[model samples]
Target chain A: MNFDKELDARGMNCPLPILKTKKSLTDMVSGQVLKVISTDCGSVKDMQAFADQTGNTLVSQTEENGEYIFFMQKK
Target chain B: MKKMAIIATKGTLDMAYPPFILASTAAALGYEVQVFFTFYGLQLLRKDLSSVMISPLANPAMPMPVPMPVMVQMLPGMESMATMMMKQKLKKHGVASLQELRDLCLEAEVKFVACQMTVDLFEFDKSEFIDNIEYGGAATFLGFAGDTDICLFV
Candidate 1:
């Protein structure tokens, strides 16, 4: 998927991934997509929750091997 | 905008993580977040966090390299060892340090309010804490808490 920015949050746990995502999105224009790759299993649900609360769209999420990949669109 | 009010009353290393974690995360999610530090919890606002150590004594859930009986945990230097082990584990998992979490909260504009009563009761110098934080009593916090969408006491 095409995205305006990419955030590598691998190895970070809990709020770090979410916080980094929030920070990254603030730099992008609305409707632009962000690609985030994370290794924290907890971030799968957390990313969805963050997107839900912030009104940002989690365009899609997938897992390859042990890494979780997420596409988020800024609201 | 949603608002969150958290009352933090414990000062232990393990106990300290929750409020800061929630506050920062809530702020990231677009919530107006406030954390009120009272009693021992006020230690979190201290300029130096090096003294914050986790105690394994009486905490059976603490994951030590070996199963430690409470009697063994009570030995001298055990707290330091436990704290070191926990720190290593957290680092291995890429968890943010307590200082990092607090800094993140501040950067996210999460309001940190120190309990004035506790400060006075403990005779703590105002300069001992970080800047850009408010000092207030219960009523001051309740003003925000009463109308908040989510309120927690940690």
Candidate 2:
């Protein structure tokens, strides 16, 4: 997936990963894709909910080993 | 925006984290968050929390990687050590400090309401806090809480 920025939220727990993602996405241009890698199992649900809440589009998501990879296109 | 109200009632370090963390998270989730700081909770909005310490004596469930007994936690200097350890852990996790969290709340447009009665009772000066705060009484906070779909006392 093409991404304008990357956020490595591995090892971070709930809220931290999402908060960091929110902060990073705030600085990016609209319609840019943010690639997020998180180890928190909850990130699967958290990112989807976050994307919906913020009006961002979840372009793609996949899991490799334990890491949750998500591609979000900012609205 | 959906609204969320939080009641913060403790001043200890362990007690201080939840309100901000949850408030910021709710804000990120597209909720218009409001935090009512009353009684000891006022310390969370204090101008300087650099001296805040966790009450290890009261929190038995604290996630101390190595659990310590009550007597050991009661020893002199243990509380400060624990507070430092917790702060370090938060920093290591890339979590924002209290001041930064407060700024995030402001950035998120989270409404911070200071309890008027508590301030009057404690004889605290109003000027001792950061700017952009709103002052209100129990009724004011209750009115907001009543209107909010998600409200809790943290």
Candidate 3:
């Protein structure tokens, strides 16, 4: 399925990238996907916790060219 | 299902901004946000407001070249300078001040709570605070936070 949004939070510290991602997701409907890119090492855990807490589905996570990408579907 | 509660206990100006900013943003995102101020954090609720509070110079958590006490002493008029810089920066970026943010939160029907124990400890009258403030204890705030989708301690 086509992702509904992309959030590039590279170089941002913890909480900020996750906070921004949450803000972006607020406007999306259920089943819509969001693609997140971040450079913070803490983001892996932060995003995972965020998805679990918000009941959003984390579709996939991958790393490429030194950046981390997370695919999530809004719940 | 958007709801959040932010517990604010720091008195320093820099530290104070996080809770207000986060709470305001949450409200803007349609979350039913509540900010509970306790301990030294009550300084933000003072009616006879002075300049924005400044962070303690000697925090262990602060990255160091200079110690905090020395930093505070070295920078005469730095508190005002930092406050002014923050004001300008927020305005430039469309972020709001604590007062303005508090107003917006009220306008949006977000909850603002002051810890009753803190008010008593600091010898402040409830009348001395801005309007729309609710009074409560830890239990009260905890009850609200229990069902919240987000909870932050700042």
Candidate 4:
């Protein structure tokens, strides 16, 4: 799916992936999608928690080749 | 978003990290987070602060990735060496630097409370900290923590 912004947090750890996603989401209008790619296993839980708390939508997420891909929509 | 309050009490590298990490994450999660620094924690608020020291004397939690005798940790220069190793490990894991964590906390609007009593007792130069840090006593911090879902002392 197409996204409004893409953040490559490939090597970053838990908090960075989520924190960067949040910083990006702030400028996004409601309904805009953000694509985040991360290698850190902990990002999965962190992003999920972040989305759940911040009222953002964790539209979809999948992992391939050890990299977790998350598509979140700004709420 | 509800409120979260963290009391940071130590200046060591290991001790300083928990508040920064937890408070920043809480703020990012849409919570109003407040971190109150008292005692040794005031060092982290200094404007020219560098990396913190590791208290190896009794820190069993300190990771020695390579197998080493516990007594070896007490050798001269070992504390600094351990601190340096910790910094490198943190870097290798892509963990944000201490300074970056602090900046992120502030950017997320995490309220930073500096204890006025400690400030006066230690004679800390008030000019050493960045602006936007609120100076308060126990009453003020407890006021913010009054109804928070999470209240932590780190």
Candidate 5:
């Protein structure tokens, strides 16, 4: 299924990017995906912890040209 | 997917803890959190003033039940004590300082907005704040708040 949204959280800091992603995900339907692009290095760990804590699915993640991209499915 | 906005305006010793703690905890809990600093809250972004921003004896918001004058006498050094206590509590709980939190937000990609009106009012140049802070107006903040699920005036 097509992801519901793309969130560009690049250049933001820890909790703000995660917070924005969380905010985006809340409005998403179950099973829908959100693509989060961030420049923050800590988002990798933070989002992992977030997915674990919230029961959301971290579908995929990768780094390209210095940006961190993550795909998450709403629980 | 819950979105929350916290407006941080007070920068007193007692006032600082709640916003940071609540915002960080909210982020930890998987909720999206945004903090908008305005007025005295902007002091938090000031490296020099941040550490010195304390409640004076005249502050009505001090927790003492006594009159302001008496409270000052009754609680000499309380601001420093409170600061120490907050630092200890944060360390014990693994919470970061305002500066560290700012770094963590940068690392975590958290969004931070500083009110432009306050900046102008205080004659603060953008360089006075940490790098990467987005400058915005009330309309911008309201736009974000409008779309968010929760909003708080702290």
Candidate 6:
């Protein structure tokens, strides 16, 4: 999928991945997409919660070789 | 915007993680968040965190390398050892340190209010805490907490 930025949150635990995602989204303009790669299993739910609470769009989420990949668009 | 008020009442290293983590995340979610540090919880606002060690004796759920009886956990150096092990595990899991998490909360504009009564009761010097935080009594915090959508006492 097309993305304007990429955040590698692999190996980072709970709040770190969400925190970094929030910070990254802040730097982008509305409608821009961000690709986040995380290894923390909990991030699967966290990213969804973050997207729901923040009003960002989680365009797609997929898993491959234990890595959770997410595409989120700024609101 | 939604608002959140958290009363932090624990001081140990393990207990410290919840308030900061939740505050920062809530702030990031565009909520106006405030954490009120009272009693022993005020230790989290101190400039030096050397005293914020965890005690295994208080936490039976803590996983240990071996089965540790209550008597063993009560040893003089057990607290320090447990704290060190927890710190290592946190680092290995890429969890932010308490100091780092607190800083993130501050950067996210999560208000930190230290309980003035606790400071007086505990005889803690005001200068011992980090700058850029507010000192107030329960009423001062309630002024905000009373109307907030989320109120938590951790």
Per-residue accuracy of model 2 over B62-86 as CA lDDT, tens digit each: 8887878898989999888888989
**Residue-by-residue lDDT tens digits, candidate 6, B1-154:** 9999999999999889999999999998999999999999999999998889998896888889999999999999999899999999999989999999999999999999999999999999999999999999999999999999999999
Candidate 5: segments with Cα more than 4 A from true spot:
A1-53, A56-75, B48-52, B56-95
Highest DockQ scorer:
1
TM-score of chain A of each: 0.98, 0.96, 0.93, 0.96, 0.95, 0.98
Q: In terms of TM-score, how similar is model 2 to the real structure?
A: 0.87
Clashing pairs in 6: none
- Number of the candidate with higher TM-score, 1 or 2: 1
- DockQ for model 4 equals 0.81
Task: State each model's C-alpha RMSD to the native.
Answer: 0.9, 2.4, 6.0, 1.6, 11.1, 0.9
Number of clashes found in candidate 5? 14
lDDT of 3 by residue, A1-75 (tens): 368899998866544566677778878998999999987777788778777766788898888887889998988
Candidate 5 docking quality: incorrect, acceptable, medium or high: incorrect
Model 1 iRMSD vs. native:
0.4
Q: Model 6, B27: alpha-carbon shift in Å?
A: 0.6
True contacts kept of each: 1.00, 0.58, 0.00, 0.73, 0.15, 0.88
Measured with C-alpha atoms, the lDDT of residue B52 in candidate 4 is 74
lDDT of 5 by residue, B1-154 (tens): 7777889898765576567756665665656778898998887666554464455445555454344574454476876765676566555644445666555445444566899999999898777677777888888888888988778898
Please write out the lDDT profile of model 3 over residues B82-127, one tens digit for every residue. 5565566555654445676556557657788999999889788788
* Candidate 1 local lDDT, residue B39: 98
Runs in model 6 with CA error above 4 Å?
none
Stronger candidate by lDDT (1 vs 5): 1
Give the Å shift of residue A43 in candidate 2: 2.3
Give lDDT tens digits, candidate 4, residues B1-154. Answer: 6989999999988788899989888888888999999999998898765647885667766667776676887789887888888889889989988899999999998999999999999998999887899999999998889989999998
Q: Model 2: runs farther than 4 Å from truth?
A: A10-12, A27-30, A64-67, B65-67
